[model samples]
Target: MGIKSFQGARKHQQAGEEIPLKVSDYMTTKLITFKPDQSVEEVIDSLINNKISGGPVVNDKNELVGIISEGDCIKHISDSRYYNMPMDDDRIENRMVKNVETIDGNMNIFDAANKFLNEKRRRFPIVEAGKLVGQISQKDILKATMKLKSQNWKK
Candidate 1:
């Protein structure tokens, strides 16, 4: 989506024609976070159990550190086979993407959607005070759109 469409959405909201949705409004607050020192097997298990493709990696203090994904796990497995190493020997810190992109909870839904389109990221950790507060995904944006479509607006 372009900035013009997003601006139009904001205008629609300002004119009381549509609901103004924010990232915090639809973001998944109950997040499944991982630690940098955690084992790759545990990360895979967490991803499977949580029914998510990836999760943020946080320190003990709950600070946003990195991100781990299914792709990262697969690469770990591949590297292990090539290097004759064991899967359990690797840690999330070794495989996780340290340079991460994050979003603010108060950001508009359209802006978040635009980021998803441009950045090509599956999910983003929502930060408050540099700490992980929640996560938003493309699916979440779709859900917000569905919610908006279901609403009966006043003329």
Candidate 2:
């Protein structure tokens, strides 16, 4: 599939109409998170149960440390020689990653678009003071884009 674009979606279009865009505007604050110590099995369950690819991996202090994705889990499985599946692995600590890409909660939509383009991730964990606050998916940006386009077209 071709990569999506969020070029103009990032900027707030002030065409005599309200353009909806903000972390608080679209972010799901009550979203679930993962623990770095959580088992791979648990990560699988969370992914299935929550119906999401992955989530922010938080430290003991509930701070965003890294992100876990289905792709990450799959990488471990596809590369692993272990006979045991997720059960054999506990809490995905070893599999869980650390160097996560994050964004400030107060970051403008435009900034997020830039990060998304360069970072090459589907979603970003919103962090403030090193704490995990929320997350935004590509879907959010698409919604904002459509809203802006529709609003601008109406004028």
Candidate 3:
């Protein structure tokens, strides 16, 4: 059992000679985006219906504007009796959130990990040249972690 050869660790080859693993590979491509004018209730329902915890928020031009989380809805729930109450037609423009954290699809997993682990972000909205594309989450990062470890084990 000299140095316990890594022969068996080749099973988790997430990347190979012909294919390279990327954030986009693991990210949720079919993103469920939100409009700033979208009601908090609507976002909450979307999160539940899609079985996702968060997503990117985009404007009418499909530009990334903000990122909304399930926790945001939970906090907003304390603001009113009916959490689903639609936004006031007149206030719709002002109701949509704008501050959101985003990342590029080509960013390495290590950088993504550092951003999420060292920063205050619960998730990252995947963006491309100012356009909302998809989203990467803590769950997605965890998956990358396992995959990276498995691949390195064979080195």
How accurate locally, in lDDT, is each candidate?
0.88, 0.74, 0.69
Model 1 per-residue lDDT tens digits across residues 42-72: 9999889878899999999899999999999
For candidate 1, the TM-score is: 0.84
TM-score, candidate number 2: 0.75
* lDDT (tens digit, per residue) of candidate 3 on 13-116: 44445333567877877877777777777777788999987777777888887667777676566545465553332221243346665777888777787898
Model 2: per-residue Cα lDDT over 11-121, one tens digit each: 556557565556556676887787777777788888999899888888789887778889888877775647555455545667766787777666667667788889888
Error of 1 at 150 (Å): 4.1
Q: Which stretches of candidate 3 lie over 4 Å from their true place?
A: 1-8, 11-19, 81-97, 153-155
By lDDT, the candidates rank as 1, 2, 3
User: Which pairs of residues collide in model 3?
Assistant: 36-96
- Per-candidate TM equals 0.84, 0.75, 0.73
**What does the lDDT read for residue 21 in candidate 2?**
58
